[model samples]
Target: MNIVVPVWGDAYLDTFLEYSLPAQLAAGNVPALEGSGHCYTIYTTAEGRRRCEEHVAVRQLTRFVAVTFKSLEVVATYNAGNKYRTKSDCYAIELEAASRSGAAVAMLNADILLADGFIREALRLLRLGKRVIEVTGGRGLQDPIKTALDSEFREYNRIISISPSELSRLWLANLHPQLAMHYVDGPEGGSFHPSHLYWLAGEEGVIIRAFHLYPIVVKPNASPVKFSGTIDDDLVALLAAAPDERLIAQNSSDLFCCELSPPEHFVGDVAWRGNRKSIIDFYLGYRTENIENLEKEIIISSKPPVGELWDRTRRDSSDFIDTLISDLKSELLRRCAAREADDLMAKAAAEIEDDGDFIKAIGQMLENGHPIPLALEERSLRIHLKTYPDRADLLQRLCAVLGAQGKVVPLELEERALKAIVELHPDRRDLLERLRLVQVGLGKTAPPAALVSPSGEEASQTEVDFQQDAEEFGRAVNYRDMEPEFAPILELARRFTMTSVERMYALYKAVQYIEATQVPGAIVECGVWRGGSIMVALAALRALGNTERDIYLFDTFEGLPRPDDDKDIDVLGNRAINGWLPHARGNERSNWAYASIDDVRSNIGLIDYPSDRIHLIQGMVENTLPAGAPETIALCRLDTDWYASTQHEMVHLYPRLSVGGVLIIDDYGHFQGARQAVDEYLAKTGTPLLLNRIDYSGRIGVKVQKSSVGWLQKLGWR
Candidate 1:
């Protein structure tokens, strides 16, 4: 019987070959195509070779053709359409008999060895409304993942392989290098494949044992070829460089002895030397190494020995001794109980309705300060909504999540957005402070503009005065960074920008900030809740023809990754009300809602700026730095009210101020986290400006500056 075997990038072909009976037609005789269907066109050497030829005058020549493409084959061998095992439509196949009712199709895993990037790619394909086969690995058969899996012959867009052991070490090395290497043994079922995966990380030895008792001929190279594993940084580099050594072993330790080799003959000459075996060759079944008086031939590769630690490289500077001492010191004098803290966080993140309300759930938990994991990230998203209180502020959600989580969070959209905003405006404290508010506050929509003009052209003098006064009120309430006395803005009032709907969201934020601190620029509230008043200031700037000066937005777009030390933070994803959850880096950008700087910039357009003056830096404030950081900032928006973030912004942005620049904080009125960080920072640096509280509605704004003259100037500006 004539048949066809479709394969992926040549890695799994032999596996299928071991189980199938080859036709009399030789292996090299089958035609192969790189990227098309009908991969192999087989012909009889001297007679008719029919796929299912029933010619009365001719005899059929049975042959097998191997194709590297994906196609559905209809054969009578087995019924796969109704009983397919997976959800991958883009897979390979070997049509043993497709001319009749049921057929045997090889559903190849396309996303072998790739990670982070594919999940989104698959989703993107699905979002275009395509039905993609979701591949996941877990013990549960009734889980949502299994329902998502399909079994078509899917295309292999990305072919990557990795060692499961290596993946564990890679993850650990990021957290602790020595610790990762120490425990990188065994098949850790802990690492399961996500939905985008076409293939899972497998033990090569196990596959080799089933494929062949003897070694196949594969040449050695300078760069080690990848077999299969997590498609992380190391795995990608390895696969791009060298071929894997395909060998089998009895135990895990013997994996080191595995070796891959190519045919031992020169290109054209078939000097059929001794048996094809050095030790365990499959070609001639354990042939001797010596040929009759033949010259020594060596298989030279492009690179050297492989699997040497690249990502797991541990330098003396980042060794265990240093980390151990640091961790030990930190473990002392801890205030909160560990289990209690974890329980509190988990409780904050659990049990939210998926009405996509976005705010109700996230706002509640952030107010409670919850953490999240993969199993309950959706719940985290429901909580993040409370942070913004504005549907249009969707892009800012990632910064809050990443800041609350860590550099690498679970969500991809959150990761990219956080990185972009932080990169564009690291010095802007409002980014962190607003993110904190998103972390802590219940999500709410922005109130109608308290300062608005129907024409929407410019703010009235009365409205401007109202905004200026609101700034003053916030300053009056702030006492932490204040001295004996300080003058305030005369018209302590609240005002909004001359815009509508989305743009008006900024006004609610300004009102909130205005209520937070009353002092114009002298008494500062570092982190503003919701940023209503700050948005007002930016609108005020646009109204006053300062469109050339950019309003920078800084944030950890993923709402802060898990905190490294003793720091107060809101629940994860709470800051991003009415938006998607946070995303980790190394994933595709499409998965993220505010994954790019454009997402953040797009949010600012609602403010009605000249469109050129709105700058965004997305990342952890510490991790995000502009190329040529300014020497002295004119207006330092300290939105990161927490001690660590506030401290970080001050250290970085303080040096960038011009004389008489304003450092307006969004959280000078509340949040002990901000208060502690600001106090210690000022104590160390000797800034004597006091924080006078401002209250315009529920927001807070503070006036901060270099001197009394700066304060006076700030007051005049307000």
Candidate 2:
């Protein structure tokens, strides 16, 4: 008899020779055929051969059976990328070797261990004209059982010469009783036995059959074609062979084997028997005459046959088995629910018609205590509100959830929903009050006075005072101390900005100065990377009741331009360049400074800032500032870090700065080029300005003295 094994990587090769191969040989599972002139052929890589030679078990096996190592590369069509195809090609080589030697071939997985007398029985069956013998009743050793027993078996050093019967005894005694005992007094008793019955119905008719075929032995030249390495490869091989010559052995007697892992798509433990049945049904459906017609009609038996021995074992181990089944069921349900939720969300995202299903999926996830992402939940609720606009209960629930989590609700969606609910039930003071509070949260000065009265009457003094108090309380929350009011700002900073809190607060203070001093002009910002600083300013403007100003934002919006190497070199002697830092020439899109115009627009939209008030001028400061900038700027934030752009902005925009207007120099302390531009402009114009330090990199200076000299004359260009 010729035993063929394909050992691939170092891990599989080491485990097979060290543990499985030695265990099989010690148990007398391999036939002692040294004098019979038959040999075991191992097809493996060159590395496999180098490692195999170091194994003492390989020398021991040579004493019983001739062991030959052949290069797996002999399969000229071997696909290294597809492991199953590689294995199939190796098997083809094994078949060719067996046919040439005129010996029966035992095709074995590298990861399996055979029982004593198994090879002898297979060869005997082959001699009786059984062209193919497929072994059944093979037990899969779960990892925990395999680990514990392999350790103990190695500690005892039993691999050199343990009896074959002892191998079965060791496994049967230690395996979970639910998997170990099968039948009483039958051939497969005291072992794990999995039998799958596949039933399929199609246009051709219904066919019911059992499918279990692996660890096969074949007579020389019995298999006609090489295996395809697909899931149905074994079935294809069996179908190709003459039926009368095929034998599905009743395995536990001497034809048993143990697999290191369960078959693909099948989980360990009795609870997952449904998965095994489903896998078999699926594969068998492919073999039917019409797969599309058979897919919906196919069904497999979920319950496997349980013999009297299993019943008796269940009585003794009922608690353990029940707990295992319960735990597995819970885990399986969780995974199924998560997958269903993901599928529903994807479907809803792909098509708006599935929003109802999406909502139910979120509700189910919430009930199951799964963490639904805030964005997903918000989307689901938005869809639900859109579909059923009159659902006030859902609107209330949304508000309560957002309030408890302190999450920013999609302001536009929530506001529309609240207004609709308030309109529908004008007498519901509670609904009106909720709408008023939502409006206040949204930075509205007050809910329209008519909204406070159902009959279009103005709100009384008491109601007006109440609204003012609420607004004051909303603003007075100590956000810098990490109050709940800071949650949305923190979230915005995390998503949009790479600036320190001090710098962000400086932007806020700039907004405060414009609001306090009543400086009249649109807010201007240069170098709006992802618009983080500008977003902070906008949020502050809304919070401080100064949202009327039109904001001017300037950026190349394609990331920074190629910096002047002579003028923009950093303190570390690395030139400031147009890419991700450190090497500074590649991966421009991934750089922290890179933000497309659309990204800034999206960030601004998140806060529901009025879009008409935002003027995003997309170009270098040198070109865009002169043409597109606001005529009178209350807040002139210069963040263009290079000397040329900074100097140009200082020359063109500084002269227009309102008296008492805030001038924020974002990189004054960090970028030498920016500091040079600011200092040069201040010196040339003789402007007396107090530049206060905000952080390590930021400076804020109120424009106390407007420059008398024109920007062009100050640059000596006119």
For 1-718, candidate 2 gives per-residue lDDT tens digits of: 7778888886577558866686667444674443586678888888888878777777767778888998876653332133444566666666766656667767777777665566666666776888777643334554654565566555354463333344445445443333322222223212222222222121111112223355467765643444433322343353355657776553244455655553232222211233333232233322332121211211111122245544444343334334434544465566468657755754554454476666676666544434344456557666776777668656855654454344655776577767777776678665566666667778885644432322325444334565655544544543445444545765675446656666777777678777887786778888887777788888887887655567788886656766776777654344576322422222222222556676789878776676646767766665455645655778888887888989999988888788878899988887788888889998887666678998768899877542533453466632
lDDT of the structure predicted as candidate 1: 0.31
Q: Please report the candidate that would top TM-score against the real structure.
A: 2
For each candidate in turn, the TM-score is: 0.27, 0.35
- Total clashing pairs in model 2: 0
Q: 1-718 in candidate 1: lDDT tens per residue? A: 1223322223233222211111111121121111223223221211122221343111212222332222233221111111111121111112212223232122222111222222223323323433212121111111121112112111132112222233222222222111111121323322211111111122121101111121111121333233211121112222232212221222222111111112231111111122111111111111112110011111111122123231122222124334423443344223135436645655654544464543465444344433344234444443555564333234454334444232333334443354456566687554544443333333433422343332434544234555544544443444434322111210111211112222233333343343233212211222332233345555555444443343455654433333323444332212321222333222111123222333334434456655423334444454333221322333555665455666777666654544334445444444445556666766676555445343321122233444663665556522
Which residue pairs collide, candidate 2? none
> What lDDT does the true structure give each of the candidates?
0.31, 0.59
RMSD of 2: 27.0
